[model samples]
Target chain A: MLLFLSFLAIIMIASSHNAESKVHEIAKLNNEVRELRTHFVDGKTELMRLKMESSIVKKMMQKGLKRPERPPRKIIVKN
Target chain B: MAVKEKNILNRLYFIAACMFVFAIAVLVKLVNIQFVEGDMYRQKGQERVFKTFDIPANRGNLYDSKGNLLATSVPKYDIRFDALAVNEKDFRAHIKPLCEALSKEFGKSVSYYDKIIRTARSNKNRYLLLRRNLGYSQYMRVKKFPLFEFGANRGGLIVEQRTVREHPIGKIAERTVGYERRDEQGYYTRVGLEGAYGPFLRGKEGKRKKQKIAKNQWKPIGDANEVEPQDGFDVVSTIDVNIQDIAHHELLAQLEKFEAEHGTVVVMETKTGEIKAISNLGRTKTGRYYEKLNYAVGESHEPGSTFKLMTIVAALEDKVIDSSHVVDTEDGKVKFYDRTVRDSKWGGYGKISMAKAFELSSNTAFAKIIDQNYKNNPRKFVDRLINMGLGETLGLAIKGEGKPKIPYPGDDDWYGTTLPWMAHGYGVAITPLQTLAFYNAIANDGEMVKPRFIKEVKTWDKTRERFDKEILNPTICSKETAKIAQEMMKNVVKRGTADNIRTDNFGIAGKTGTCWGNYGKDKEREYISSFAGYFPVDKPIYSCIVVIHRPNKKKGYYGSEVAAPVFKTIATKIYNDIPVIDEVSYAVVESNAVVNSYDKYYQNAQKYKTIMPNVKGMPAMDVVALLENMGLRVKLEGVGKVKNQSIKPGTKVKINQTVRLELS
Candidate 1:
């Protein structure tokens, strides 16, 4: 009975250590997710600034490109 | 000897009795401590092991109509250091390089950091702040710096992370995206859509019991939490980012050009009443413009000449006069009860039709007509406006909507001149949004739909609520009356005050409003210039309004000159984006001559694969593609149909042979 009790005690200690390590891993992953979200938001903001029409017009002005004055017309061909 | 022994026995009995009394006292004290103080001691011990931690839920993201992220929550970091953790030898070895790296990153002098760090080291400061609110990339760069690379033990690097709201579009629609904040008193101050939908955007917080296993590290005591946090639901607004960008920059340019105090622009979908773009820019003291306030939804002032549309519509609905009825302008000026109404034109448009009066935005004509017709019963005109829903609030989701004030006959501020003033859009207050809605009703064929901002609320892919077109009134007026009003507006742009904004590509129907602002109270009178209407006159898509306040008098102050240009810019942009599709009847016409030639070329290419075959009269582009795919490289010269080929079509197509084709 004494030997069986000691064996159970050892198993309990090992599982508790395993649980502790899992908690540490979860915390590390949570931090990584937070960092990734920050990077994504930063990149998105930069892209939006570049994609704005005003910015595009300003950039294209240097290349001597201007927006078309009138809308394009599509002619339908019947066969 | 017998006498001495009796004395010794008596002494021993006394000593034994005293020892027994002391033993009983010890037992009583032990029982008191075990029973009386046990509960308190047990509670104190539990306090050291168990803790309740708050799990914060992330605030939901804000998206535009096309699912472009407008606002989101992301973690920001603050970096600090413990000066005393570094020993003398390590500090001397790494401090120089560490200071150099930090100075390069922060753009400060190296000596500045060196001095501060040295002082902190001497003072043995445990917590020395290096930088606050660094983004993720900057924090990562700092972590790899000299001493900081060793982490918390040797380098004493301490990083604190907190979530903050970030707007992806920068300052484009910052005011509309807004934010929510709380004070120490637990009072929340919310603004814009963020404030209006705070309850939905701010998810519930959760709680969990945890045990401290190591330094600053906690382990949850159980598998399940006491309560689970639900992330906030996202709000999808109807604002189109492209339109918003155009409106913002256009308004900013006009404001800068005129040196105006402030201005606002609102574009609404005619049928659905969705606000596609709303911009409000106010000039700062430094001569820069920013979205200082939501003037489009919050500022209420006299609408000036733009209000003529409402007056004319009311008169037409009442059948007091037709569009062709002629009204004398009295050669520019007319007086009524200590107030004089003057037309901007010097000689005035004399004896013009009501439609022309409206087109010219003749103040004297409008004032004279309203005073003559509704003078006896002014309440009739006021009641007509109220019935049109012009006197009521729009009940917008955004906070701080300005209330519209329309005076009745029995009201305290009403006077004999109030009717005439109200006729030409004075002595009345309405927000830019309200005016847009009223004009949108005319554009929608008199179906007054309320202006909507948000389209749906969702959690990830699951939709919680979807907002649809909410009709404020089924019909604002009769179909005939609405048609007449629309035509009058069309004429205003076609040949009237707003003629400067007229376009040949598409038709615009709108009114120009220029009215004196803060007239009686201020020494110098200021003008508020505005333009409001819709485009493509027959079938409208958008109804827009542009209002600029207090433009420089020397540059120009007329609504047609200042505000109409912005309206035109936005209208032209929208017009130029949509392609014009020309439709034709699906009647087939047989061209036997071209078909026969095409068949002959196709048959020749397929008939002979190893021997040379005749090839002519095929288009140059088709011939190149066909020859290239069949393992023959073709070089074309000139343009149009293929006239001759250096090698015949079926010449045992050599693997590496180059065929030259001549075209005419």
Candidate 2:
């Protein structure tokens, strides 16, 4: 009986400790998610600013590219 | 021992009595504790362990019409240093390198950082703020630098993260893509699209119960939260980022060139009235320009000659005048009650048709026509404007749409001169967006649609709500009346004040409006130059308005100069945005002669080196190669294939000898 009680106590202690470690893991993962999200949005904002037409025009100016002066045309073919 | 056997039989009574008193006292104290103090102790134990916490849900993103992220919620970091966390030895060993890295990152001098850190250390300051609002990458870089590499406990690095709303396109459309903020009083201050859709953008908060465990960690007591948070639906606005970029820079360039105080431009689809792009810029005290306010939506000012379209439309609809009737301008000016109406041209337009009067935008001609026709029954004219929905607001999705003013006959401010002045667009006020809507109605063939900003609200792939084109007036006027107004505007651009902006690329029909701001005031005069119009006169696509206020007088303040050019620029760029597609069928050339001759040359050049292999009836080009590659000089004298060869097949060739090949 005494040995059985001792085993039960050991199991209780181990289980509580396991739960604690899981909590720590959750905290670490939460931090990681926040950091990763921050990184992703930063990259998205950078890409948007670069993709802007004004930014593109300014960059392409060094290569002598200008916005076209006239409207683009669409041609239809008849079979 | 019961008081030492109760002092024998005689003392036994006294000892029993004393024991009884002590037992009674102990029982009473136990009862008091069980009844009264139990609740207090239970409450104390509860306070030490468990807690209820709120879990915030992620706010939804704001996307442009094409799924480009306009605004989103992201974590920004603030870095602080705990001076007392690191030991003296560690701090001393890495302080110099740490200061150097910080100085390099923040662009401050190393000495400045060193001084501040040493002072903080001496003052025993634990939370010394290094930098605030750093991006994640910058925060990571700072963490990996020198002493900070050891992390929180040993490196004294402390980082605080906060979620903030971010706009990726920066300050270009900051006013339109606005923010929502809350103060301590729980009052929300909302602005722009974010403000307009605050409830939809901000998700619900979840509640959870947690138990305080060891090391300051709170372990969740249950597997599920008491309340589940629902993430906000993503709002997609009807904004084309390409067009928005074009409008913003074009408006900025014109504002800078004119040295204008402020300017605004709105580009709306003609049929649906969906706002494609809106840019509002105001000059700073230091002579720089940024988006200061949503002037296109909130500013209601007198729209000068652009209002002539409405006057003409109203007159035509009432049948008071025909387009062919001629009106005379008295020199350059005419008088109403104490006020004189004038034209921009000194020598009047003399005698011209009613359409020509509108094309010239003559103030005196419009004033005389409206006063002569509508002065007796002014209520009819006012009611006509009201029927056109001119006096009401646009009922925009966003807040603070400016109130349009059209003076009524019974109003306190209405005077005898009100009718004529209103005809010349002086005694009236309307926002740039309202003017664009009216012009857009004409472009849409008398269909007036409400200007819409948001397209839909979505949760992932599922659409929660979708917005459709809302027609305010199906037929604002007869189709012929809209047609006549359209023709008059077309002539305005084709031969009138705005003829300077006419282009052969695409037909732009617009009206120029120039009114002096603060006229007859003690302050210096300022010009409010504006142009309202639509493009591709035959099949209108987008209607736009450009308003520049307080442009320098000497730098050209006329509407044609200051505003029409901006309108033209935006219209041309947006028109070119449509991609040109031309179809061409793919064909494969079947010229085998070129390939065959090259193939033979390649083969013979390899086969014959020291001796000739076979050169019979081969092409002259191949024959020359067959002989020359064998170390013999060859001379060809024909355009066709080789008919005769001087050397026989497989004959051994001598170096530096000449061979003749004849071709047919």
The lDDT values for all models are 0.89, 0.88
Model 2 chain B poorest ten-residue lDDT run: B1-10
- In angstroms, give how far residue B225 of model 1 lies from its true place: 6.7
TM-score for each candidate, following the candidate numbering: 0.87, 0.85
State the lDDT of candidate 1 residue by residue for B1-664, as single tens digits.
5679779999899898888888888877777767888788777777787888889888898888987788899888889889988777888999999999999999999999999898888898888899998988898899999989999989889888888898877787788878889899979888887888888889989888988788977778884658888889999998888889999999999999999999999999999999998899998999899989999999999999999989988998898989998999988999997888888999788898899999999999999999999999888888899999999989998999999999989888888889999999999999999999999999888899999999999998899999999999988888899999999899999999989999998999999999888778547989999999998788899999999999999999999999999999999987787788887768776799778867876775676555545557778766765676566778889998878989855457666568888899
Index of the highest-TM-score prediction: 1
- DockQ, candidate 2, comes to 0.52
- In model 1 chain B, where is the ten-residue run with the lowest total lDDT? B607-616
Model 1 Cα lDDT, one tens digit per residue, A29-67: 988888788888878777777888889999999999987
DockQ of each: 0.57, 0.52
Residue pairs that clash (backbone atoms under 3 angstroms), model 2? none
Q: Find the number of clashing residue pairs for candidate 1.
A: 0
Q: Tell me the number of clashing residue pairs for each predicted model.
A: 0, 0
